[model samples]
Target: METRELRYFVAVAEELHFGRAAQRLGIAQPPLSRAIQQLERRLGVKLLERTNRTVTLTEAGSVLLREGRAALDAVDAAERRTRRAALAATGQPGLVLVTKAGASSELLSKLLDAYAAEPGAVTVDVHLCGIGEQERLLRDGRADVALLHRPFDSTVGFDTEDLRTEGQVAVLPAGHPLARRAGLRMDDVTALPDLPLPRWPGPDGTYPDGPGPQVRDHTQLLQLVGLGRAAAVLPDSCRAHLNADLAAVPVLDAPTVTTVIAWPPHSRSRALAGLVRAATLL
Candidate 1:
């Protein structure tokens, strides 16, 4: 049962001579012989056949020797691996964060600051990448964790946490007709004279900015409205951070874009949990 006993038994079993096995083990021949005797007695098996001039292994001794060597090798490997893991977790390691290239960059900046504020030796490496790249990195195990927008492909196998909700708002040109309305409903804006709401892509199937109003990236579409070129409705949160020149009205009747923190299924990491917690705080 003791590792020492196993070691002594194997030494003598392989060498078939206690004196030689003791030399190999850097121990006295008497102790090595006694260890083998105790091991065989505990197992209730005759392991060795000793003669005046020759020594030989019994059937049981041969089998135990083969399996004992394998057990010792496995124990050595497990100990080495455990030490390596301890070093990785507490010594020095970087937490990987992959995210979409939009507002997520701002969100990560805030999280990184919070995570770094903790005491002790800990730090993070942020990987700010495109939406497609973030998804790919998470899928391929290159990322330890990530923060992303929801309504992603379910097939990507991601989990999400709702960070914040940004509702629809309307942007209007500085001098455009209907600019005076406290808040123009989508229907009201449509009815205004030269409402100039960018024409959502018609059946031609292109996008509004792309050729669909729905598909316009925040920066470009917001630009058009910021210049007073047209009125736009976007998430209230996005508008909340905009320049004084641009204004947004909530579309009480429209769908809202909710920002969520997403990651692959079954993903578990302490650094990730901290980041997720920090994101909601901001």
Candidate 2:
């Protein structure tokens, strides 16, 4: 029933001799014989036929010899693998940056491209999900780390790095009056006929000089602006128009969107720390 009893039974079974098995196991013969007897008593099976002149394995003893050796071998392998994994974790395992769907498209691609340009450095993988969902994954330990345009709450169990700052530009129809110049001052687009903005963070009136009309999403607002239906200011990284006639011009008064890479506080994993280090040049 117990591992030590199985070990003793295996040794005795292999040798088919009492004194030699005990000597090999570095145990006394009396205790070794008693251990084998206890094992058979527990299993309710006779394992060996023994006499003062000779010893021989029974049917059950042969089966146990094969299984016991396999069990001991498996235990040894498991212990070794666990020790190796612990060492690797202490040394800082390789990283994967789980980000919001839009965050990676903005900066993560450049960061990885730079990292990959150097052939021999440590590797990091990039993943993306919605901002709210990614935060949940980090909290529940389903994900090792996160990066997003939005701030992460402390209760979500994360440390964050505010890598860099950038501003958004207003997307307007190419033929619109504001789009004629290379860039427009905040005053130029602020007075547009009708402007659309995404519904988030705060009410549409949150802007000091609230634009008259607003749409529910940025990309859609941009498409409307390109079609001369409306105008809106959005993050520069947002490409509302690629082939159609729309132009993005800088908006001077808009606040910069801060991008962050966040992870659980003092995680057993070093995914966040490693990624932040590799991204220092950013």
- CA lDDT of every candidate: 0.64, 0.65
Q: RMSD per prediction, one decimal?
A: 20.3, 20.5
Number of the top candidate by lDDT?
2
State how far residue 264 of model 2 sits from its true place (Å). Answer: 1.6
lDDT of 1 at 213: 35
Across 1-282, the per-residue lDDT of candidate 2 in tens digits comes to 677887888888888898999999999999998888888888999999989878898888889888998787556545644563475568745555576554347477777776666544455655565424555555544555566554232333357777766777877777767676777666777666555443332311243335444443444555566677766666677663333588778887777776676765655534345456656667
Clashes of 1: 12
| Model 1 ranges off by over 4 Å | 1-92, 98-109, 119-137, 140-143, 151-156, 189-216, 228-231, 280-282
Q: What is the lDDT of residue 205 in candidate 1?
A: 44
